[model samples]
Target: MANERWNLNTTSDLTAEPGTPVGLVNQPRTAAQRLTDRPSDYGEQIVPPKPLWYLDKAGEPHSLGVNEPHQFLLFWRSNVGDKAADLDDSYYMGVTGLQGVGVAGHRVTINATGEVLQPGGESSATISGFWDKSDPDDPMWTPIEPETEYTVTVAAHNQSGEFGPDSDELTITTPAVGYDTQQLTLPPRPPNDVDFAAPLPVITTSGGGGIQLRWTTVPNVTKYEIFDNPTPGTTDGMDSSRPGLNSRDVKLGEVNQPSAGTPTVTFTTPAYTTPRRRFALKVRAVRTNSYGTAYSEFSTPLRGALPASTVAPGTPGAPTLTVSPVVGGQVKLTISPPTINASNGAPEYYAVYDGTRQVAVVSSPLGAAPHVTLQYAAAQGYSFTVAAGNSVGVSNPSSALTGTVPTPAAPGAPTAVAVTNVTTTGLAVNWTAPASANPPVTSYKVYDGSTVKATVAAPATTTNLTGYSPQTAYSIQVAAVNGTGEGSKSSPAVTGTTPAT
Candidate 1:
């Protein structure tokens, strides 16, 4: 062998310096001097002494390092803020401990070209020659060939290449073309599953909420971007652009090479707030490569939320809130007759509540009985109950029911009324609130024509029924009631359907 074939696995007792780009005078070190395996003399230019961490190979601290900005001037000034940018220029790597010996020969074999460069080539420079560590301005030149393989070797003049040995030939070549950077191009990379939150689900009167999220597992990706838009409201990430990039469509902290698939994340909401809320999401894969390759991108089509929060099977029951339901802006329910004196001939008022929220309070000074014809309005399938509140104590909530109160009845025949605007869970039934004689009509009844479908024990009109079979029809009718008793069934029947699957 021309040189010593030393398989030196033994770590060098000579400590190597750690490299951190600091008051770097912009002087560059050659790639081979990266000290990745073993620390060699890392050639650094005279930079204004600032805070710098001096370390040995393997990242061990050789000593406490605090390079204060010294009398030296800052080099190659440029815009400074978040990231350290490199200036455009050619840099050289230097040698140390050369003492009296000189680099007698040097050679670099290129992979693709198969050509070699030595001491003096038009493109390559002799990195090793008469080594001198004395001058701070000492410079060394090395050469590089594109898309090629290279094996480099250096030796001294005093010895016939018997001491220091040669390095493994690094067959330099462009990464395997068209490799799925996510798969083949590099070492086995860890998967990057971008940032994700609880998905926006299709809320249903059915109890459980729906949630869908944006996700991907990519290789070499740094940040995974997730954002959403609520169909009924606004999507989660809908606030900014999808993947939330800037004018450059480059979002910060995004990852690259995400794995395939749009995943879902679930979360629960308080049952009563109607599915009036909805959303959509976008997730992206990002990669910041050492080679500065373009970032990879992927987006998804918009998704919708399912409606929930509506009236239940029973109207005058628990879990239901009687909201005015007219949709001006936000209708807050305020109590009336502040302090009802039922004992002083004042009529007892009936109230509707939303999950303990009191919306409407109704009572007449004339001491009117509970209205059978009036229907309290609520969302389609949420639980609700009506309480006859007086000046005294409050009453227990009625059974849990979903939907609005039924309409009043006509004195004559109630005809077949058709229903529309069907949702997955509930329906709207409209009919006449039955007629009254002497005093006034209050309570009302809606039946599947056989059994009482739903009843309004207090004064109200128009009810939304929840928890119904989807796309199914039901024969419905409304009747009147008062303290007297149940009135005759309405003449005509009405029908409505639940949402189709």
Candidate 2:
């Protein structure tokens, strides 16, 4: 019994050890027993290992170009040991100008998590920032001067609240600030009714019949040059390099540092003489860099006309208006213009008005049908009027036409979808009613991803889908459908496994 160990949970007879009862004195614990008695004091504290970091330009560590000298992406790999805890705490990254191994220069701290630290918070492994020399007062976490060298490093605390060692340092140099070399493309032209165009631009004649032009903005562009083809029906090829108006075109005007919102310019038209005049307009973008200025291609040409008349046109005949339903709560209004006559100045153009508000103006070389689409809310009614116009003035409004927009309730996505039953060859599914069932949901579509499995009628919440393989998993979703079309599918697809035969 000298070398035997006793279990603390069991009752042992002292007399079993022959002479143990005679002395009954305690003996020193063995080395193994002493080691097991204080387990917490033997191990080292768990702390995250230092991270290994690298700096790169667009993922290339050694090939930073002149244009990307200042821009860099910092990346690192975790240096976690077997006993180290998971990295679940906020980590800090920093960059500083370096002169020598121990020399200090400008320094800035960047949060690798892209968020401010809070107690018990975690963040992403990567973050991006830039240094600007031009604006020292700019509000940024770590602003660096251009054309300067800097070193980057990272560190983070372990779950045990111990800060790990800093990652290996990476050095980088900032590039000079300048314009991008890529050519600026032409800006998208404003929507206009010039024919076969996706967006039609709206033109309104201002006081004194001046023409105001409007268009959308282009990215990375600071200037715009407007060109006009004075001669009707002729194409004038214009670009940034050849912005000058050709023999048949004229450089109307230029806009510098266009505003962020809608861009526009106005031109004064000559006094109306006798007949009507037509003009084609186009616009191009301009960008200036250190090298020089570059231009984009000209946008699609927009056609507009100016009428000449000293007398107002005669009142237009009662327009024959037809209303047709269209998508997105809109109705198309088709107006048949009156026959051209000397009294109406040949019906140069027509104006469509919604109540007292002018909705659209359409040019008509001669009497023709002009169609306009107006947006309306559900159950909303609109009254429209048409007026013929010449260079002199607009004629009296025609008789009013009224129409009502249709209300179609499009069902929302189904909710609380779950699997009801599963068989080797078939699966059953059910869902709750959609939040919205305007016009009432007529049917429901059961989908496995994009593929439709079955169509179930309304008032029914369950459907058994067939043709599925045995011992297989299926992710299913349900969608409600009404006259407006199928609604979005339910989120968090419910998965079901079929029983094997």
TM-score of each: 0.24, 0.29
Worst 10 residues of 2 by lDDT: 97-106
- Tens-digit lDDT track for model 2 on 76-194? 43433422222331222221211111111112233231222222222222223534334446644554456767655555553323444555555666656533433332233332321
Query: How does model 2 fare in lDDT?
Result: 0.56
For candidate 1, the TM-score is: 0.24
lDDT of 1 by residue, 332-449 (tens): 3322222222222122356766557765565432212332222334332334456544333344455544444333322332234445556877767665544442224556777775
Clashes per candidate, residues 3 or more apart or on different chains:
84, 9
| lDDT score of residue 160 within candidate 2 | 28
Angstrom error at residue 183, model 2: 38
The segments of candidate 2 whose C-alpha lies over 4 angstroms from its true place after superposition are 1-275, 278-311, 314-323, 411-444, 447-467, 471-501
lDDT of 2 at 14: 33
Instruction: Give the clash total for candidate 1.
Output: 84
